[model samples]
Target: MCPRSFTSTSELLSPEPALVEPNAGNSHSLRANRLLQHAIPPPMLPVVDLDPEQVRVLGCLVEKQLTTPQQYPLTLNALVSACNQSSNRDPVVSFSEEAVERAVTGAKARGLARFVHPSHGRSALRYRHELAEVLGLDERQLALLGVLMLRGPQTPGELRSRTERMARLDGLGEVEAELSALAGREEPLVRRLPRSPGQKEDRYAHCLGSAIRHVEDSAPDEVRQRDVPSQSPVPAPSSPAPGAWSEELAELRHEVARLRRDLDELRSQLGA
Candidate 1:
């Protein structure tokens, strides 16, 4: 939820009751928290579908936790800044603290994130993602999801280089195998996109959410709005270049063909 930030270190010693602490000692709270932290049992792990902003918010938490542990439990200001950071982000954003907070609230509900009180004596609220436990992801999967959350979609080669520290994903084949596992899960964690015209490899994206947008160079006046995170209405689709209709069309055709093949396989299995 929208966690609080403290201005004085003195407040840490005698803090008010935490409205949303995940690790309360009480058995009931602990049990409830456990349920939320882990996916509902087998045969029904609900797909962690989320909005674009929630995706970004979760991604930011994971990234900061690994890359900037010193600043792991981010303050509201820091969280906002991380979410809006230009580097390693797709469809860059200018989200407000309120917007980020809203996304945090939504993320918490989905059991993919958590809000925390001050850490190491600081008297401020902080947030983190519980994706590793909830999704049963290894370090490799966590790294892959983090990159996709921050950067939208990317090829296996790109992921291999970016996920160096989070996991041992140095080879393209290694990355692809991991992606295939994620995509093949009963509740698929990721999905593969059709190849773009100029791109040699298909980009993979987290099915949880996306900030895709359609841009037109010839028609500057046409401002189309796509869906964003729960907090902010403005989406993060990196504005595509003009005259890319051909690419879009080709992608659609490829997708249709792929679906057809899958359908044929299903039919064969059914023996109809």
Candidate 2:
């Protein structure tokens, strides 16, 4: 048995190691690279929500624009005129000069508006509402609503006549159509009035209280504020600066001087 051993060259050599090519799919290194690419989430879109008082103030501003397109976007004086003309009787949501100032300040703080002081003149001061569209009204509709709200109730014909005095409308038919559309929307802000005999026209009332309620219900809790004091009187302006004339007097004097200068220039031109 010891004599049977035989050595062969091929048999004695060690076999070559099996080839291990790198995996083409499902590799740990590839997965780690993909994970790194998706590490952070995207940012969200911005949301802007306004409080009820802010909403009311914006509505008033839009109404002013509607009534006096020539004077819009309204200056403080134009705003005062628009507010006064809106109602002869006292207003339920009357905005005093101080109130307007406060509201404008608050709105600016919220990044919703910008306004300059009256000392700079109307042109120097301007106010804008970023969420005007959220109130669901155009300037014309707002003005119409303000007028109707102030005067209680009015026929479409009456609205057309009154609005036409301040604003240019295509015709009574257009006014009627707008009123009908508003009524059809089932909006809590508008209430229809019964037609009377001998008057073929339909009447409408502005349901401001209902509108307020609707907004309150829809708004979030944080934006709601305590009710304004019911009997707060608008503060009177303090006496003018010492040795300074009233604004009206100063304006009149300037006008007279301008007229005199104009007259002198005309006379010189005519060689008189």
Candidate 3:
């Protein structure tokens, strides 16, 4: 559906049903959207069945909400920017405005998005995701989902690192535990993908739908935290070792001690 481009933010917020007046130059076919206004939202759609575009649109909304709440409920133009961003996305895309709007419409039909009227005196309409509410997901799950949907499959180690700014999955173990919890759900939100060719670690793909097309990795499949926009697997031998962790902590402690000594010397100089 190309989202019969029309203006009807009022329909979404109005208390009572009203005839949807299509925009000038549009047709009555757009009137059907009125049903979505008063309609009991459709049942939660399975993330696995969503099309790649739908997944991307929904994920962008969730990501923006979590990462930049001040800019939540993104306008169509802003949303288009997010969908086309090069970073933090797998096999980056440049979806056209029409394509993104259509995807947003598909997501709304699935009860995963909402249309919001212009706010703060802004004239253009804005939209928001109902992803968390529809999926009944908590903050942690939402964070993971947003990343998975935006970036495609990832390993537990990757998930833990990338989600640092969003959730509290302390380490690989916690990431695994949380993944298990999500997988255990009645409609599993995630699944372990069969190991990619030569991949030492099995990656986890989200149920929000598979990538539009399989994207083969160019780099040798090493199970470790990568510099990519998404997931991090436990590092291989070349990756930092556990002892390195202690050494880093030790360095931090030494820095603190140095600062303390410096403070004491300054205090002595001041005759305190």
Highest TM-score model number: 1
Candidate 3 regions with alpha-carbon error over 4 angstroms: 1-48, 210-272
User: Of models 1 and 3, which has the larger TM-score?
Assistant: 1
lDDT of each: 0.75, 0.53, 0.74
**Model 2, position 270: C-alpha lDDT score:** 100
Return the TM-score for candidate 3, rounded to 2 decimals: 0.60
Per-residue lDDT of model 2, residues 1-272, tens digit only = 01111122231132423333435794775666556534424221122233534545554565555555555555655554445554532245556766676765665555444564445354446565533232355545656665564554678778877776445557888777667655554433455765544568766765544443342232233223323335778899998785566777888999999999999999999999
- TM-score of each prediction: 0.62, 0.41, 0.60
Sort every candidate by TM-score, greatest first.
1, 3, 2
Predicted candidate 1 versus true structure: per-residue lDDT over 50-118, tens digit per residue = 777888888999888877888887888889999998988887999998989999988776666788987
What's model 2's TM-score? 0.41
RMSD to native for every prediction?
24.7, 35.2, 22.8
lDDT tens digits, residue span 1-272, model 3: 11222123333333433556678767564756556554744333253457888888888888888788988889999999999999889859899999999999877766668889876788988999876765667788888988888888888777877888777877788788778888887667887765665567768778765443233343234423343357578766777789999999999999999999999999999999
Worst 10 residues of 3 by lDDT: 1-10
Show pairs that collide, candidate 3. 157-232, 158-231, 158-232, 158-233
The lowest-lDDT stretch of 10 consecutive residues in candidate 2 is 1-10
